[model samples]
Target: MGDQIELNRRYIPRLPSQTQTQSKRKGAGARTWLVVSKLGQVSVEELGKQTVMRRTGITAHDLRVVEPELSYPAAVLRRERAVVVNLEHVKAIVTAEEVLVPNPRDPRIASFVYDLEFKLSADFSATMTREKAMEQLPTDTPPEASGSRREAKMRYSKPLPFEFRALEICLQSVCKSLESETSTLEEEAYPTLDQLSAKTSTNNLKRVRVIKGRLVSLTGRVQKVRNEFEHILDDDMDMAQMYLTDKLATLQHEGVSEDEMDDDADVILLGTDINENMSSKCSTLFASDLKPNVEELEMLVGSYFVEIEGILNKLSTEYVHDTEDYINIVLDDKQNQLLRMGLVISTASFMITVAIVAIGFLSINIRIPLFDFGTYTQWYEAFGGCVVCSVFLYIMAVLVFKFLGLLG
Candidate 1:
């Protein structure tokens, strides 16, 4: 029994506890609840209040106690051996990683960290090995590994599961924070590349979820837009399939006419008297029509054929042009994102350079005829002035770019 207990304890995850009660309600009486769950099978409710109290280092009495002096009603609840935090004081739940917000009322809000979780899977180690091998393997090794080989492979293995798990948790925290904000945005709310690039938040809001046997990020709001577009594309394909089916049915019904049959054909010879009479009439009509049909019929058919071809050509050209336009639009968006990223990097580099220059400048002592500027105090003041100017310029440039719609 003791050994079993130890084994179970070894697998149990360590819980990190943090508690914050709202002192006051801010903006629209918004209440944010942070829910932690595992595989949707476990909820906070399953975890008893006592367990939470133990994990969080809060006394059992605190769970039952109420603090009316605190501005908001807050409590911790356990579900499925996990903790749930209910907060009525938070105006927004931002991710712990950087999130790009347009036209934020307060810049300081950008730094707000969100709590989230990351799930680490055992398959990641194998995936890493496969990726590394692909990058550095010899020509003799197969590009793809078989299931048996994958199971047996242990090259470059490292025993850092704990570290990897911790890192995964940290990443998860970032993803969750980003996801909260993204969920609030509409599907069509595509941030421009510039906006995405200019975003300097350290919080990441996303979670890794397994779907259809694939691991995918479940955080960003942009994924909804992608799904919406995919749905639209599927609908279009369905419509096209229905249209083609209708066209095929019409073509099947309007196949070759009886009058076009040969005089001594097997079809006519094998038929009954009624069919024979019909065949005879069709043959007579065809013989009479054949001579007169040559000139006028050919010209009419030729003219219609030309018009049909012209229409087809026009449609093909339009389709090509539209496809090209779509490609160009996508390329332009990519280019814009790259441009914005470059700008941000350039700005950061410039600021860093200014800082370095100011440090060097401050370290120097200057002696002037009009004034004695040789003192460290004077140098410090000059460095401070330079720093202030540099910061001012950075702000101005950012604002200018934003105003020009070059920065989001």
Candidate 2:
């Protein structure tokens, strides 16, 4: 009797004392409940209560939220348990982890992220008991059978199962990566509007390329999320995820052949044809329930989407404008400097021309000082003076230009 009691205690999961459960709930400041189940028949929004209608049919994808008070890590024993008893609820808890961002410090990480995770229903652990099997056996059943049953019970221990932690951990990691990006953009790497109004430099040019690349990356992340949601939503049949556990139970109660389950291909074919018939009902209910939620999430992300859009648009616009103005300023300065050099060269040319004309007259028999001070000198001397004056004029022009810091 002692051994039997010990065995039962080891196999069966114990319930927490009621007092402890109440005290734990009281201490926990806030709680969030999400509907993880996807039975087309059940909806929290439609029902409007803490209670969800219990349905026997459940899947791993149906886990909704992680209860803060629940010691989720301790409960989940993946190695020990082949299948969770209420695995759908466990999956809901897993889904909850991915859907909500625990710490939403960065606005760039959209309000929520959601994705479907599928597990093989066929792989679930066996729930049928040895007691039930024995009741159906004949009185002549061998003693060895009981020994085998005990050995099987000892070997296959039931695990204390809850939500899988990996899903949330992965999503949170991505969000953290996103938050870092957003924070970097909002703070250090990007310049403010006022700084942008300042002179453009090589540094600004570098920043332009970096900002553009960042914009592209962020856009890709958001789009990827959008595509995921759309892919699920577009198929009304898949979106409904109607697991008719009760209906199947009812059918079983009506004496349907047990062999029907083994013929999977036929079941799938029949289900597809029936699904086609029931499409309208499922689609209507699913669309009505899901569209608002998807849209609401999109709406929350809508602001951030617009924000990224605005940032990209703003960055592109400013980059072009600043670059254009910088190029224009540089070109204008070059043009003016060229004109200054031309004016100086032209003045020197004019002086040289005047001297040549005077020398030409002196060369002809007009042996006179070009600017007479009432004295006569040799024609060669006057000519020599004219040549010196022209050379001097050219040198002076070069010096003046150099002094003004314009020629270079």
Candidate 3:
């Protein structure tokens, strides 16, 4: 009986440890996303690549541009149904009515996610309140009150589209991040450069080098973002494409078939006809109020472009390069002084060596006429003569160096 029990126990599988099970669950959750919509609805789900592609109606290639591991450049690609944004540290897919951000739990993006949700919710509530107030307005108002009503309606009705609001938030976040980093860099760089000027040291040099490298990197990023914005601003079609919400609303109101709407590229190709139809549909009273859709996006992007331009100017290499040049001049002066001192020492050493050789001959055991004639007194006088000659030679060497302009 005991042997049978032991065999059964050996065949049975052991369960995984509690920690291992928890870690597996945690890894699974990391791939999940927190999706937010303009209606203030929030849902958490494990959104795979195919699921996101299906949800946003974007191609796999567009989706991959915002993938966390790809390290893609700052881009804002307008797709058939989605706007793929891959700005610094903020990667998201924005559609007409919804936004899908991967890894929303990451500390880097958590604040953005929270802010987006709050703003959307607030906008929704404010919109509801505004609609209710409009409905409550009396139909038999006086002429002056009617005018005020028209003004109020105009003011309240022109809220930015959902996508533009989201884009605005993203731009604001990126700008704030850049501004903060720039401020920090300036703080660190200015003091370090100044200290380096006052007194050069290994540590201070390393700090300045790091600061300059940071400045160069920041400048590149700012320039890249500016170029992307410029590219969109220069192309009217690109800006129009970014108005995903407006296009969808227009197409739906025009009774466009689902098949036609599915391929936004074709819709865009036929935008001229659609725009005329939209213009005709507008009431004559409000027709004058209608503006080009691209105008809003242009103004939006242009404002940030100006902000980024200012940042780029702040990161100018003029100050850094000038400081570097000054440091080089100081270093060169010190090096030249070292070289001149070494030359002076070498010349004195050579003169002293010559004097030593002359005195050394007297110490030789070989017979010499001078040695035979010299007593101790003569020996002392000869030694004094050699010392005097050495002094003279050293002075002559210094004079030659001065004449050649090497002493300076």
Candidate 4:
């Protein structure tokens, strides 16, 4: 259970430490904390029994939640949950699952499908902003008393310090989850590609579309995540915003000398000795004041983001090839059926031709009863009889073949 929980079932609660001036605050820690390296970014989080693993106000994502509503043993882990962290924007809506529905291209999915899900596309600034004390303040809470918001939802969870090895463990867990899912799909959908039948061609195609569509959606999601991290890494201002806790802390420690209510307030004289330089002191604070090169964070999540994307891409390719194979097999089957029907039709034509040949013999010059031989009237009577007999034999033979189920 612990192993399963760590691989992909782990979730970090939105903590108060993440939003406050101190990473050591009682609660409100960012679910992940980043450490940068030349190789890539690292994310680390510590999980323990007392850790705040579940809560509201943040999305829950993991494998069990993705599977159907069937019961699963409550997952618990004894080790402190530690996962390497980075600021990447890879988020996919939790895909749902349900009872069996055989699809040529995918395994059975959840009966109830959800339409809306958030993407992990937040830029560095937005990501940092989300981690800020100001952002964590509930809408009903005033900015002046923002500390109360952190206090209300505080927890005792520990932060996994930025470490490369720890990050690897976290990433491996995610990879494991993805690998398991891909393997399941291979077993459920890809194996029978060659065995698909003509009767279910349309259904197979529909199922294939569902699977391919999911992969395509995942590709876009992974790309967006990679792009988000890159955007922050390239921009200094974006990086500075990630120091949200520090900036807010600085403002609080300095105390708003200007009108605290309106940051846009014009310079007002608190004392005659005050010079123009002192006016609107808060405005003097700029992105330059916030250091962008904080070694505390590294956005190295793109590597794994792309890796997962590659997996999804590979799955999509397999599905495409399988769909084509199934379709080709179905078409071949239809063609064979058509060929057999053509042979049946030719056989019917031959039977009619034989009947015509047998009737033609009666029209040839020969003696006949109750008529003068070689007279025009006798010849006309023979010709009429020949036509009647030929028509009757052809119709009878067709009816007999149809009745015997041979002409279908």
TM-score between candidate 4 and the true structure: 0.36
Report the lDDT tens digits of candidate 3 across residue range 324-408: 9999999999999999999999998998999999888754633445647744665676778889999998998899999999997
**Candidate maximizing TM-score:** 3
Clash totals for all candidate models: 29, 5, 0, 27
**Model 2 error, position 408 (Å):** 18
Query: Any idea what lDDT model 2 has?
Result: 0.39
Candidate 1 Cα errors over 4 Å, as ranges: 1-294, 300-311, 314-317, 366-389
CA shift at 309, candidate 4, in angstroms? 2.6
Residues 1-408 of candidate 4 have per-residue lDDT tens digits of 133223211122333454333442334433321222211222233322122222111112222222233333222111111111221211111100101111111222111111010111112234344446444556786787777666654632222222322333334444555556666666655644533443455666677667656556555544554454455455555434333233333444566332341211111112122123322332355434655554444444446556666666656665557567767777877787797678667766775676567557765655654464444666567666766765676677667767876555
Candidate 2 Cα errors over 4 Å, as ranges? 1-179, 182-281, 284-331, 346-408
Q: How far does residue 61 in candidate 3 sit from its true spot (Å)?
A: 0.7
What tens digits encode model 1's per-residue C-alpha lDDT throughout 1-408? 244224323222243342112211222322222222211111212233333333322233433332222333333222111222222211221111111111123333223222222222233445455557655644454647554354444553433322222222333333334444433331212232223234422221111111201212222222332332233233322212212112222322444232222222223223323244323443333344322312322333234334333333432334334433654676688789999989977996898698878777666555442464354565557778878888888888888989999976
Each candidate: what lDDT?
Answer: 0.35, 0.39, 0.73, 0.39
What is the alpha-carbon lDDT of model 3 when measured against the actual structure?
A: 0.73
Give the Å error, residue 158, model 3.
0.6
